[model samples]
Target: MKKFLSLILALTMLLSLVAVSANAEDITLDVIIAQYGPNTQEWFLGKGMDGSNFVEKFEAANPGIKLNLEVVSWNDLYTVVSTRISNNNAPDILNIDVFADYANEGLLMPVQDYCPEELYQDFFPSFIDQSVIDGTVWAVPDLASARALFYNVDLLQEAGVEKVPETWAELEDASQAILDAFGGEVYPWGIDMTTDEGQAAFAYYTWGNNGGFVDENGEWVLNSDANVEAIEYAIGLVNKGFTNPNPATQTRYDLQDMFAAGKLAMIIAPNQLPTYVTDKEGNVNLATAGLPHNEGATSSSVGVMDRIMAFKDDAAPDQAARNEAIGKFLTFFYDPENYVGWVSMEGFLPAVNSAVGALVEADPSFQAWLDVLGGAKFYPTTKAEWNDVKQGVIDVEQQALTGGNVKELLDALQAKIAGK
Candidate 1:
């Protein structure tokens, strides 16, 4: 009887160990984050020797959780994410731009269900509104960005321009003066007429000029008088020798590099450029100003936000468990302390309003960004129509700026986007 009892006890212990192992296995989760462009390697892998320490810290805090990260180039982010979704093999979490494309699709999970309402209210209304669609919050604003004018003070001084421009006419005058002063040795401005950056810049200028990309009924309105005038003004800058020769071939990076090297007097770029400029010890005299508006027009520029998305279908049998883990991670990431690290390191404005408090207390240089966010506006919302409209606008603007007829280009663009 004693031998039989001993055998029974051993078997019971073995069963309990097996059950524990199963529970541990069930707790592990797979998460994928997309990092693209020049910033990808930094964002995912971290900057210097502390490679993936953030990921390590996260995993250490959450027992039995495993994270799988893949670093993808920015060029392939959209394609890979889209293909995964179409193949019914999406990641547990994904990062998406704060445009209408991903939000319009029902691919992302509503974060509001997992996050607290108070937390949700902490973001700027415009920031929150962009992520909310069809009465559901599909994503959380991870980062927010605003456009500004970056000028080389030395160049401006060389041109004998006492102050940077605040209006369209002032910009033109400044440009012309710079042209006369430098005499082809330097370009007065370096504006990108490329597809992505140029379209965004053009939209802001046109909107500031009282034109917009879409009407109340969602029709394309790029051919409006205000837009035409804005495009003409942009082209006029080039004609007056205010812009670099052949801006159509210039990319955003190229323009920024030129401005940083003091080759260009002025450039329209994101507020984050200051961080990059400061890092390179390029020029301490660099100053950022709000984007100039059309004569007698209000100050307005295109604002963009980045968001974190999670798919419900991808969560599978462990949906609730995975959602809980993701919610915790997001909360931790957005926590005022941890969030500041990411934002400051990444050189992006914080999406959380509470983070503004941290920024003020920690880094005063970012105060200007907080002010910029107060009046920022996002791209118009449309389901699956963003890419089409964006491409159409770029095509038209490229043609118009490259000696093509502005009226005909705008007309064709409007018609093509409107399906006319």
Candidate 2:
């Protein structure tokens, strides 16, 4: 830890003498970190996870660079960011899920402009691929999670489900068996079509059926035959009394609670399901399996990742110097010494390979999640039309839940996205 002491000494001198060097100009980065949960605010600014202050350490490491960091809840982040962007006062660094809008709008700096090459190389290649538009990478993943089928083991055993369903037909049969055993006391399956996670509902079935938001060429293909069939099958499950009664209103949180309480026999959820259940004091024998696929289709693990991106600042006098400072910030943030806690604290999988061994050491369960994440298929966030497609699929599902034609709704969405 000699390096740590050196940083401390540098910071002490910088504070007392007010300058590390005559040329060391002070730089303050305005950063907005999304509040993922209760402790995120404390992790970056206060005495939170590990009781080590991130800002203090970062500043000490690089004397002249100060962090004016703000933690914004997900609810207010979009509004706060939008207001700032419109006012041409965007933060130097931002953490959020969707970045295509900012990137396409020319509001974000290319990752190459600020990301350290060694640090950039440490990021998972697949994860980095998701943030690229054309040939340029725009952001880096903060954390990632894989979605899979979580089943109540005791409930399934009692229901006579001999094996975890691997295909849609088997899933339907298992669902029916659970229905027969529970007699309406427990939902055989949980489907979330609420606005909060409706897009995810689209992914569960469509991606499972080998029908996804885009084609192999990354073009919008929402109304393809495969997608129509997938959506129809999902709606069929709800109609057949095999799923939760109110798919349109029941959110992921609601479904998670039901699953934890043994009220839902099966649900598609992330790796953090166990952590969530434990925290909520819900008891159940839970096991996970890949999402069931349709016949002749693929069973794909759905991966979810939120990103950290830097914004363009045309007003900066020294772009290279500013980018270097940003690089140092990233380097510090993802250092295994700091990143392992950030990922583990949030109960998420790491986006960088450097944090893997440490995370798995801390929790063996992380290894299994890492395995699932390896083969996972991500959303097409690289596409400029991603937000529209995300919301469009949700709308299509909500309408179909209300008896609208799934095929017709998807066809309409396809045309809308195509500007037809």
Candidate 3:
């Protein structure tokens, strides 16, 4: 009777082991993506991926891996991510603009842990560098958009402006000409100093004046001489009635809408402005020019990029298998055929070199834009103090707009951030 009972227990243990093995073969990844536009959700979960969604196709190709992808809007992304992290429920994969905080906190897995070497090599070197912190790559750039000066060709001609502005003096001259021609019926230039986009305003003007958030060595310089001059000049535009009224309240969308309706003559915008105008059914004849700079300052195209990062998940039963699954997901996502379509659908620039040829082939203008992006200067988002500087500059700009001294405000901000 004792032998019979032992045999029965052994058989039951064998059955349990078999069940565990079967379950180990399947894994699920929770991915959170920031919505780029109206098409972002459709492309990922709907029928935007050549009649098949990304989740469906990826699962079909990799049978063992399943995806739970969620699209979060920009407004709530930071809050959502923060809440999840506080609850220790961080997503397996995250797509967002900032990563230094996560990486610095040791919550992210290094890129090499899951990214295939071949796929890693395909990313643009400059773009890849942007995600590095202290010799470690924390994330991979997903996509980028370069900013430039967009003007209404007919409006400039009608204003008797002979050529596109390449310097601040020229820009001011053109603004005056447009104002005189239209008698203030149209805003000569658009500035977005609203809280939602004041960082961009800071970049557009400060970088143009040979001042930026950091030095060549990536140290903070928020109160540099050039920066003070830049802020003063921007405020001067408002005081002189050369820019859109209520810049403190007007946002990029408001400016874009004004541009679409011919209420704005010139604005610094992303590459998607023309598509934006077309979508709005506007018939304005637009032309692009390099962002104007101070006479001796170098002109730089401002590039905005978001990244894909994997969070640390130490609780997996088989770490190697999980890493391999993540790698497959990235490979499938970055495959030139799929990447080209995704980039084109959103009208943004590709982050990988492999998609460049196909994109340029589809649109000749893509080549020119790609060339511009190659030399573009990006924000210092990799810094641990990036958020402080971003909000600090915006405050400085807003304060300057309302009778606050630019130098004093910037000095205080610099002191505050430096102390941090």
Candidate 4:
């Protein structure tokens, strides 16, 4: 009788296993992506906003799983994501750049828990280093862009400038000559000292000056002499009528528009300017160089990244399956042939060495832009207080640009960030 009871219990367990496996045959992954507007190319060939047709192939290869994608703008991303997270209804995957903050809040799963070590090794070492916070991989890099000096060749020539400026003094001289040559009819430079680009531009200038927001010991140095000098120099350009006079009211897009209209000689922007500045006539005589730095200082550009991250829901019944699907999708996404197209279409530098080789062979024009990535410095976005600090910095910068004292503004900002 005891043996008979044991046999029945074993049969029940086997039946339950079969039922669970059958249930796992059908899976759906909810995803949220940031829309880059119409100009943004979709690397994946798919029916919906995810843009890659890879979804169909993925589904065809794995019949049980489906990817449901929703597109959100960068302006709405945090708000929507936060609301979802607060409601305990976050998506399976998100394409975003704020993983560090989310990771700090315990809202993310370390990719290393799901992705293979070999897969992680395929990423650029620096990028991989950046994605890890508190010793865990929070996000996977999708694309990266480094800031560079984009100059209108024809405009520079018209201003009697023989070459693009390589130092702060040369930049000042070039701007003065351009303004004088054009009789102040056109802005000589388009320094975007607005809410959108101010912090980034400031970082580029500070980094180019061989200074940054923090020191090697992670101290807040917002009011460092180099930073103060850089900010003041930018403001001086506006006061001198070389940059857009009302930069506080303008945005980076507005600056780019002004540049595209041939009304500005130089603008410091990400490598995407080439894609943004072209007209129906084909392309402009755009020339690229590293951002100008203080004399005798090492030059650096700011690097921006977009990442794809997977989430974990401990309460979900199909958690393991979902994670497995995510691993598979990431592996598929990073394959050289697919990633190379993504790099070319998305207008970002390749995150892996293989993609870099493929991209160079496919598009040689990106060599200068690629060169800038070597000296790219990043804002300290890993800090839990990063978003708030960034907002504070932007506010202070806007104040400084609008006739407030740079030292006073930065001092206040430094105090606030330090307190945070």
Ranked by TM-score, top first? 3, 2, 4, 1
Best by lDDT: 3
- Model 3 C-alpha lDDT per residue in residues 1-420, reported as the tens digit of each score: 999999999999999999988867799999999999999999999998888899999999999899999999999999999999999999999999999999999999999999999999999999999999999999999999999999999999999999899999998999999999998788999999998989998998899999999999889999999999999999999999999989989999999999999989999999999999999999999999999999999999999999999999888888888889889989999999788999998999999989999999999999999999998999999999998989888888899888999999999999999987
Error of 2 at 86 (Å): 1.3
| Candidate 4 residue-wise lDDT, 1-420, digit = tens | 999999999999999999988867677878787766553324343433245365676777777778786767788888999999989998888998878767877778888766766778888788877787877779888788898888989888988999789998999999999988897677888866666666786786778777778888877788898888888887787788888877777888887888888777788888878887763233468888878889999877788877888877877676777788888777776888667766676677877766887788777877766777766787787777677667776777688776799888888888887876
User: Which candidate wins on TM-score?
Assistant: 3
CA lDDT, every model vs. true structure: 0.74, 0.91, 0.93, 0.78
**Which lDDT tens digits does candidate 1 get at residues 48-147?**
2155545566677776666665666566778888798788887777776743565566666678656766777776777777766666767778888888
Q: Which stretches of candidate 4 lie over 4 Å from their true place?
A: 1-24, 37-52, 279-283
Task: Please say which candidate is ahead in lDDT: 3 or 4.
Answer: 3
lDDT of 1: 0.74
Clashes of each: 2, 0, 0, 7
lDDT of 2 by residue, 198-240 (tens): 8888988888888888889878899989899999999999999
What order do you get sorting by lDDT, best first?
Answer: 3, 2, 4, 1
Clash-forming residue pairs, model 4: 44-51, 44-52, 44-53, 45-52, 45-53, 46-52, 46-53
TM-score of each: 0.87, 0.92, 0.94, 0.89
When 1 and 2 are scored with TM-score, the better candidate is 2
